[model samples]
Target: MQLHSSGVQYKLHLCLSVTLELILKILELKLMVVIMIKDWNVMDLVCTCVTTLLLVLICLLLYFISVYPENCGSYHGPHSINCLITIWEEVGCKIKGLRYPGVLTNADANTLKIMNLRNVKANMESVKSAADGGNADQQLNCYGIAIPNTCDSHNGPHSVECLTSIWESKGCLSEGTKAPVKLNTAEKEALALLNLE
Candidate 1:
């Protein structure tokens, strides 16, 4: 979850940085043109400068809005769900030759979801099995938790509480736990799109 949030922020920063660089380049070009054309009328020069600045401002505003979309009612799904759709497209995750055309239909979403679920589930089950293994300290490392001096304060191996906390922290729905796994927006959407959610 933390990784996903960081990834989104990094993308936004990269986009904004690129945008600013482009604006700066355009401004530099305009400055050069103004310097070369010394015969330009004052009013005309002012108008040109104003127009250039306005266009840059507008472009920046539009880009900002797109990066941080407002909460539109989630008929298709939540804003985060829509975000996943974008990330996948950027990395060339394609689902060509649609069965029923017109974007991701129910059938497509279901198929994608099922395929994703199979992969995620298999990985999760492996993790769970490992978590339930002999060494408690090792399981701590498995979930990215710091190894404590004692497992469950010396409650020892097969400690259900320790096991639950480790798996639950990583958002895995282990066999016995009733609580649903807490997923990030993109993960949730990806799972939903694949029909794994």
Candidate 2:
């Protein structure tokens, strides 16, 4: 009632502020889950990490919009804003891994092609089988994939959990190697040209 009495613009500002706080809290919770969950299996880790990433991206977008509402067109209603957030979340998921639920997100039909490692794809089936067979050695190897000590090793799936079932079957990660934190010079230049520079 008090908020309504403050008039439309004031009410909208209040609402947006409240919404930002809520979104931040939610993102914090997701981050907490990402770190707190111990004894995670491949499936659990993949889903949780992807979900956390999407939430983090959403939070960033919300913060930006709250700070720069003028950047959005006047015609955008609450529904449009919701749709935009949903789309961004999906994009974040795709970047992090397969696009959730199911389907080959990267669109490369061959798992080997998606991974981009020679001989790994052909050997994927065998590796997956080994991973699935409770090969502790393979599971331990997956740890290397998780942090990836070197950039040279970072060329495959977005996450170890993103690999196909066959690939994940081996050593928790199968063939999923971490992607690099920093992009190559060409990729950086491309983004810069787009003004994401």
Best by lDDT: 1
In terms of TM-score, how similar is model 2 to the real structure?
0.19
Taking the tens digit of each residue's C-alpha lDDT, what string does model 1 give over 142-171?
Answer: 333332322333223323344445456667
Model 1 quality (TM-score)? 0.24
* Model 1 lDDT, residue 135, Cα: 45
Off by over 4 Å in 2: 1-6, 38-197
lDDT of 2 by residue, 49-137 (tens): 55765676566445443321222222223223323223323322222222221232334224323232223222433433443345534
Against the hidden reference, what TM-scores do the models get? 0.24, 0.19
Q: What local lDDT score does residue 47 receive in model 1, on the 0 to 100 scale?
A: 61
Q: How accurate locally, in lDDT, is each candidate?
A: 0.42, 0.36
- The lowest-lDDT stretch of 10 consecutive residues in candidate 2 is 143-152
